[model samples]
Target: MITLLQNGAYLLNNSEIIEANNEAEAILKSKGVVETKEEAKQNTMAYNILKEHNTSGNMEKLEIKFDKITSHDITFVGIIQTARASGMEKFPLPYVLTNCHNSLCAVGGTINEDDHMFGLTAAQKYGGVYVPLHQAVIHQFAREMLATCGGMILGSDSHTRYGSLGTMAIGEGGGELAKQLLNQTYDVNMPGIVAVYMEGTPSYGVGPQDVALAIIGAVFNNGYVKNKVMEFVGPGIKNLSAEFRIGVDVMTTETTCLSSIWKTDEKIKEFYDIHGRIGDYKEIAPGACSYYDGVIKVDLGAIKPMIAMPFHPSNAYPIADVKANLKDYLHECEERAKVSFGDKIEYSLMDKIIDGNLYVEQGIIAGCAGGTFENICDAADILKKSDGIGSDKFTLSIYPSSTPVQMELIKNGVYATLMEKGAVMKTAFCGPCFGAGDTPSNNAFSIRHVTRNFPNREGSKVQNGQIASVALMDAKSVAATAANKGFLAGADEMEGVDFTKPKYYFDKSIYETRVFDSKGVADSSAELVFGPNIKDWPSMTALTDDLMLKVVSEIHDPVTTTDELIPSGETSSYRSNPLGLAEFTLSRRDPEYVGRAKDVYAMEVERREGKAPAGELADAYDKVKKQFPDADAVNTALGSTIYAVKPGDGSAREQAASCQKVLGAWANIAQEYATKRYRSNMINWGMIPFLYEKENLPFELNDYIYIPGIRKAIEEKADKIKAYVVGDAMTEFEISIGELTDDERKIILAGCLINYNNTSK
Candidate 1:
């Protein structure tokens, strides 16, 4: 269904693809295209949008100032706190704070609602927009209110994509948002653009999630589009609706791309018209000749209803194949669970099989991906044609992405149709997508149309011997499976079903009545509100001349995600309290990580108090002193670090790295980072993003690695750093950090982004 080009190709008037091979020049000459490859590269839609936002006046290296920025409750509290510490008097641009992820006040008493109140007060004091709880998710609100043609938006959530609306939006960590609030630029190198050439239309039952999964499956494992911009072009641009393209666009984050933009048409303009923002719509397309670094050609007609099996969104398979080989597929999922869980719980999908047919307990269609108006309406049509979902163990829940979408659904009768078919309708909340709401029973299986399906993401604690898994599917398939009374089924299996494609009616009154919009006017006299759960950041010291780091955790997993590093669900309420949230660091992947890091932190505390470290730490310091006589307790900072094969795979939550920093972590040694956002999080938190490429390490867990002249190396931009393992004997190993901007270097020297900004003030 998806094919990746092996060589760079040129699009001729957005119609024909001419591969840039030895004979490419001759082919281009015949078509009256005379631009060279280097000149043609700037003709892409991504390059044009980027050039408009870039303040550095250089394409090779970019310093971007976004048009707008947004955050949700799980992240807004920390972002605003960081900005306040950095001497930010008011928001420099349009900022939207949406209370979606932590909207549920069920956990941690009043913590969730307290954050919402704080958001409202901050918006008023700082002159920003505040969308009330249950009004809308972050991305949905951004799409309806903030997205504009050729505009750029930065959000503190990972799935922040509005390319289908002709906007290049990026989802980054909270630190980036804080920088923007301080009127700082986002620094990076120019990203490559990949063309997603589409042709034909999708089959009857195939949804946008199916097309997205097929593309992700082809590109994720091979790093085809990693850190690149996906520019949608060709005939396929005209075949999909605005919402269908949006559904596909949001899932592009799973492929690890930096951002995305698309060729716009009247359909996109109509979307703006429907939302009463027609002025924001404009046509965008490639020039006569444009070059792409790579191309992913999608055959929409060939795409089947797909299911991304447990543990990852990239492990995709056709529903037909999975149903044919039920036993084999279940066994594969079991094996993958063992790798992730490591015998912590007895996990099994075999019992879910009844009479050789796979069965699931629950189905959810929620969050930004599946909660859109188009996906939910199509699902409602499918459910209306079948017997209601039975009352046994099978259940279904539908959550609209925003109150506006819910209101239209109510008027259009889509909500009643779904409710009549035994589907529970919930308000706009992102809790189910990130493990806060609708947690299933132990060993239960659920099918969702959400962003991710990582382990423990469904709110089942592996530490408590509770294991539940989620598989990602399109909303139509989930509705069909619910109609089957829990038996595995795809929407394609339902014959003669009329999919009454409904027209969406946008309602702005729902938001105008409840949301708090400051209209970019700050109130200097407004008092800030604070709850007991909200706390300021703890003090952090600058980098020392030399360093001694203990390896607290060693993870050999092929990839380590942010959820495994700090976890979600119950811990989300503590995001605003830095020290409080640090306690859950690595709680899911390594239960002992917190205690081990705390022990090293205690030693550092003693050293800071002018006392020598006791026991093994003292012995390790003594061994380090034997080689470097100048390395003393005063000069050498003591901290902890972790070694992983590849870290920072999923989620743009800054807590993954900040939690490590709060627990006295000084560095992370990894072969390579999975996403650019994660590495930026580490740099902003004052942790070294060390690159150790060797298969075998010179140190193990609990071993100390001492680096001499660490501060000098960072200041000098040394390509290679020398560190010694303080074991039975001092063994030396080389480590290096990849390219860093001058500002990034200053941030590390000053301890963190907050301190860096403080020094500037």
Candidate 2:
């Protein structure tokens, strides 16, 4: 069973629970460590082993000098554009741009491939590396080349986790990476570190997702590990393989943690060696007397197969629990669908959970978490040992994490085994995980081993009256579900199956030959190629003395994900072009959101040039002037839309916030932010993260809200804020912005991270 520790606990000595707590406290006291109540305060470890290695100051402020960094096509274009605007002349560090996400450019049009060409030219001009489309997915390529023990890496994607191999990897918005490219430091208050102590070996049925979901459910809402670094340590490290550990590591983002790391050993060394990077391996472990702010002890022996229901990852339950209480669980899933799917479409999970049995229409094992070799091989073994149950009603698809893993599986006859059992294997692609590949029929129920099961993540386009649902499960359960002809089944029930673990063989020739490498050489003479679809960001105006925003949409969904705002799949190709992408903002959530925003945008554009706004916008401006009694006392700014109420949750996709900016959204007023990365995305895009404290709202959509002296408030770094809604009552609300660093305030004041960087340049 997994348990939360009230205090730190010692593990190495196998001491009694009481003695373990005492030993932990004693170790801390002996090393001159003290605890504080400050949320963001820095606490040194019980011992100073880092000082012996580097003789450096406290790790709170660090100078990270990395050999290289990497991002993919969907993300690199934005990062590079930001960096270039920030005075980046060349790639100071080796930056590899991989193009696996937008590989199938021909789907929508040839324009997506043109963006790839642009990326290739940028790599050549900027002295960077470029992996052509289909070479490999971003994380797999990085695992093979970039990770090093004790080294820190950052990515723009939320799933950017490599802790299983000892790298303290963080997934932030594009702005953070742009800062690095411009040779700037990542600034944040030193975060707390949590020890995830594990013991006991997991049974054959329990997989990484099972363990990860359990931890996520415990720590997500409680903020147990929020913004802290999770350091995995214990004998459990030896019981699992590198891939299994990686599956758990990637889900750390769901805990709202800043980053993650694990003690490295021969398993990590073997991982590096297989990827032909023996030199990159460095043994890393926590000191024997290391201290943590909090501790979570997980006994793998008790972990059962888990599934994260609808809406959020935190809505998790064990398979056995769901089976025993199918009616309640299914009802909960339906209620969640109402908020997640909205009124745009009708969806029900009760049909899938018929006769007290959960029946899924589709099963997928893909993406960073489930696409590993061990996951695929285990699934293959289960399928091979079972009868060839061919049913058209149930479909299964698998995508290996990388080309190398695919090659290894093929060589070991696992591919043939899966194919015989009617499982179709695809290439290394992230589309299935984020709503692009293998889209299901309307109202279809799917079980996936992917990272997320957020609504509309299955490429359903619910706003168009099409809908599909997915449940997050491990590879073992997915395979078992497929074996049972789409009936949801746990892995433990299947006996007499030996999951043969095979040695992984890495092949690097595919990447070495296909990918373009500049080897850290800058070429000033090279010219960047721009596609027709590629467009520059529109000029953003500074915050006016007073601001007026018409709330185009106000959502009551407890959480709004990036997928709902901008969607994935066909719309993903527009990410490189800000204005082009803006057209898809809220396309899935509100089919008319883009048009409504544009209508408001036109008026704002007219007003910016000192022209009278048209339609109701002009009338609203006149009404505001009547109250002020001085037409010129406050300046007016224009924007097409402003989304209000609790929003900005899930995914580090900057496009979630950026698309709104591109669509002429002045700001987003919310009760609070869901993730640090999403809030950072808004700041980077020059959108105000207006906080509203009132539990009940006094404003409606399409109503103008004015916040006077906003520019002055930002300059003075004011905490409490007041805004008035334009109505007969002139409703007012109290809101406050939480603590912000000097740099953060400046970035918001300057309109965007890019503009701030440009001014510095």
Top candidate on lDDT is: 1
Error of 1 at 400 (Å): 0.5
- Sliding window of 10 residues with minimal summed lDDT for model 1: 621-630
TM match of model 1 to true structure = 0.99
Task: List residue ranges in candidate 1 displaced over 4 A.
Answer: none
lDDT of 1 by residue, 665-701 (tens): 9999999999999999999999999999998988999
lDDT of 2 by residue, 638-746 (tens): 6544454556556777888888887788788788777788887887777778787566777777888777777788788888887777765567776667766677777
Q: Give the number of the best model, judged by TM-score.
A: 1
